[model samples]
Target: MINTLRANLANGIQTSSTRKFRSATRLLTFAAIAAFGLASTSSASAACNGGSTLKGRFGVLVSGGTKAGAGKYVDGTMTFDGACGVNGFVSVGENGTVNNFISVTGSYNTNADNTISLSLALPNGTETYDIGFSPIFGEAIGVETDGTAYATIDLKPQTAKVVSSAPVTTYNNATLKGTWAAACTAGSPGQVDLNYITIDGSTSNYGTFGNVTGVDHIYQAQFGIQPIAGQYAVLSDGTFGGSLTVAGAYPFGFTGSISSNGNELQYNVIYGTGVIEACIAKRVS
Candidate 1:
């Protein structure tokens, strides 16, 4: 059952790009509002059951090194309303020069497998990105549909002091704190097997989750290019959660879910230059 789900998850990542054009069109409505400075009144809150996990304020970083001729990077903050609306500003950098802040807007689709599809409107064009959340839900990692750019997003509950005040209801951390074996696969290719243990109510034990074994370096690197090792903080509201960088070589974030019984944890880990790795961690003790 686990393998089947993992395979399906992998397939979803591969096919997510097919909807790029369609996604762009759907986001135009929000883009127009953002361009006109009407974002303050834009509402994405809807009374829907199974509340969305994408609601909150996110710090985003986009990086593409000469993939399209000139290296590009974007730093900005984006806000999502848990339904499908998003708005933000991006500081675009090209060839090591900071350009100007550009307003952006878009819509997103939350997939059944915990992946997210986003269509963001930039001044130049609309671009699509596929993001994956980690088991706890604090961070997201994504890449442009054309693979020309990549991004890492750090999210925090809009109401930090009162998580319950957020639009969505999340799981309790006491029910999900533990150690488990983890297996991860990237959208591109290859798989990684490792172990992860979460504790302190909101932090993870940092370790590697990539090609440490005698796996093929090329294939392993495709999915597990960097060592999947870092300390991650579980979001206050649960819902697979998010993370913050306390002290580390790279920033980390993730979102996902723990099975009702708390034995299974499924999530995506986002880190270093926009890489999203789907991970399943099963409690063994």
Candidate 2:
């Protein structure tokens, strides 16, 4: 089963549109196994105090490239025990029903440098991940220990707690207004393009999109400007919701929901050609 899953992940990586989704699905498959197979009651070591920083539920987005140049993204949720254990679910496809769905359980160690080492035990094998946390607390970036894959994840605390500082004001035109450093990926068959932009989200949000090629390298700026227009609403429940349109050479329809803490935004977007992309963006004001 592990070999089959690996084969599927490798095959999915070759295609641009579904690479991350496929990889996430496989991860979730192991999650499901762990949830049912592993024991839930485990004590944390004295060195694991950093787990407290990860308590609560978080929305996760993972994107990485394979040694062969295939790019993949994974979307899911992870819940930490504030001790050392973690349980989560991941999926691929529209509404998480398309290709695969999975639940995972694991142990983690928080390093002194704000990085984490995670180990997930699956029916087939154990996978290790090295994760780096953002200064914002819950947001993090990660990569496989073998360097075969890399990913970025944004986590939103599901429970109310004192953030590093007082919570930012509610999501409004004023609070949302800023120049944000944005990274995005547009995936299609045989080609996956990464985009980096400086987004000004004031009255009418607009920015320049740079076509980034080569693994983890940002080259010169490419042609064309991307424009976005949208309105955001702070729901009664404290979640942030909004919709926007990308009026550019390759247009996209985007909808997003942000955590109450105002640190991370989870987005689901569809291209004019009907290709779907999902990502998490952090506020860098």
Candidate 3:
């Protein structure tokens, strides 16, 4: 179906009657696929299952973040070689100088994004990663080089050996669980409250929801109001609201939109006007 769609999309925008017929033919084909459900792959599902034998550790470059001790940090092995899964350990960097080991594991399935929401355990505690990667291989991942579409892990203790790692399960929305750092913007003092989605069903349509803390007027500390769940789509209402069953221990919510950028699940949530609070909560997933 994806291939058919791609072909139809690139067939050149048509206007002639003959072209229209072809366009209708392609559209009908896509519809037929949708009705019959041509989007199912068991191999992808099993890639990040509980136990499998295809496991391995990898080493990749670290980029992004501007803190003095932020760039070029490697502490744990990007480990995960299993039959029905894919995962890795993000090396320790500025925030990784304390925890002994920090890693994640889970299953993933997507063409544009190689991801799984594995469990992320650290010295401070354990959380899940909106874990993402490009090119699913043993140790040959991290091709984007900007650290944009990878697991957004918290800084942990530095260790030479990879202590742990696993594949994140997308079916469980592992992309919507984690600790996010948001500031107490200028005006929205109380505590910036936000909620959002992190999992990218694709590079396009997916959802992340949130609310933010109001700004602090006196101390000037950008404290935030975290949702018990990592994100929300309810918009303060209870309808489409998404909740993180694992964020109650924190204090700030998030500020991003559940979006799909015409490709796959990508969090396009930004700091919009009244649409969002002062400080924004974006899904780094």
Candidate 4:
């Protein structure tokens, strides 16, 4: 009878040991899965960099005016050192005077709202802007914050290497060779104009620089849709200038910038009269 009791106790102990072993195995498996999930999350966060991903060179466009009747338009290139420091060169048109290639220095930081704040020291004075970046990290839209000027800014990623000398990169006349869809806004106080344009950038067109041929469909209360043909040029630095003219319509000159990846462009119009104009173009094909 003692032998029989001993055997039963041994069997019970073995069963208990088996259950403990299974419980430990399950806990270890759970721990390993949690660890893997944590590691994956950390890697993704590092890649996104918390939306402070402003690095390398970017093409910039600013269009607007101050309250005091001085209109401002700018096309430039800004290079971020990836450490909050930045250098810029811009062709600025203010009032009736146009200055080509002016140098500016600045610093930038990202805000909680996913906006970047820039404090730039121009030759005239200091200016500040708040820029909201796109999810693709390739483009952004910004506004001036000083209350003195009403400005809208556009930023596009460029593949330029340096800003000190002429950039030797793939961003050239050929970079803009594609079909793009453009949306533009321009007007004075009571007369606003909205333009939807289709731009064809091809080498077969006629121009010293690369050719930009487009059809501008004007949407206004007076005219429903005017399919107007326009032509422009793409410079070595990816900026462009030309005119769009039609019978009984206003002939206006335009200046623009092409992104390094050849996917986007921004343009602004210049007229003798006081007007606000800007265009953003995205490649469709």
TM-score of each: 0.39, 0.48, 0.23, 0.62
* lDDT tens digits by residue: candidate 1, 109-171: 776776887777775467777787553545567777845554333333322223222333354
214-234: candidate 3 lDDT, tens digit per residue: 222223254233333223332
lDDT of 4 by residue, 145-167 (tens): 97867988888876543223333
Residue 208 error for model 3, in Å? 51
**Count of backbone collisions in candidate 2:** 6
State each candidate's clash count.
20, 6, 82, 0
Error of 2 at 7 (Å): 40
Residues forming the 10-long window of minimal summed lDDT in candidate 1: 207-216
The TM-score measured for candidate 3 stands at 0.23
User: What value of lDDT does candidate 4 attain over all alpha carbons?
Assistant: 0.58
Better of 2 and 3 by TM-score: 2
Model 2 agreement with the true structure over 99-198: per-residue lDDT tens digits: 2225557778888786888775433345567777654554556776745445444556544343565554344434434434445553433433223323
The full ranking of all candidates by lDDT, starting with the best, is: 4, 2, 1, 3
